[model samples]
Target: MATLDESERYRILSDERRRLVLEILAERTTGIGLDDLAQAVTTRQTTGTDVGPGTVDRVRIALHHKHLPMLDESGVLSYESEVRQVEQPRVASERHA
Candidate 1:
């Protein structure tokens, strides 16, 4: 279960879109990337909103400029983890003087 603080961090997202995205991610083991996630939200005709349209652009802009950096900074999700294809650089145990 997500803590209130964890959930609250996403208040930047409107409730409707956040719920929509969570629904999609809930159905999948691997998470969707931002572009695909936007398409999923917007294009789902069953939903009452046009989440498939500007939401994608908004999500991309937010992730590129805001949300992702904040999430990364908060240690919620690592930027390196999102880049699955790239081998994450190992942190050095010590720095030389």
Candidate 2:
């Protein structure tokens, strides 16, 4: 399991979109599909703003290339690249306790 330090945890939560990912994951009892997750994140990020087309794909790519890896490395989430699925790790919940 990935270890967590104060700096790392803070880093994981630092970005608004990344924080949104965590929030969405926490609500899901099952792993969330990448497309669904991207849609949810885009919805939150572009709620009152004029979002351009391909925003969801951009979010998906960013999550795949950056944010998800950060969360996985921080022990917060288990990201299955092959399936493009994400689930909150057990240690992540324990860390919150």
Highest TM-score among the candidates is held by which one? 2
Clash totals for all models, in order?
Answer: 2, 0
Q: Provide the RMSD of all predictions against the true structure, rounded to 1 decimal.
A: 7.4, 4.3
lDDT of 2 by residue, 34-94 (tens): 8899889999988898766588889999999998887887767888888998887866467
**Span of ten consecutive residues with least summed lDDT in model 1:** 84-93
Segments of candidate 1 deviating more than 4 angstroms: 5-14, 45-55, 62-97
- Please give the lDDT score for candidate 1: 0.49
- Compared with the true structure, model 1 gives a TM-score of 0.45
Error of 1 at 95 (Å): 24
TM-score of 2: 0.83
Question: Which residue pairs clash within candidate 2?
Answer: none
Superposition error at 66 for model 1 (Å) = 5.1
Over the full model, what C-alpha lDDT does candidate 2 score relative to the true structure? 0.85
Q: Clash pairs of candidate 1?
A: 42-51, 42-52
Model 2 lDDT at residue 46 = 87
TM-score of each: 0.45, 0.83
| CA displacement after TM-score superposition, residue 97 of candidate 2 (Å) | 23
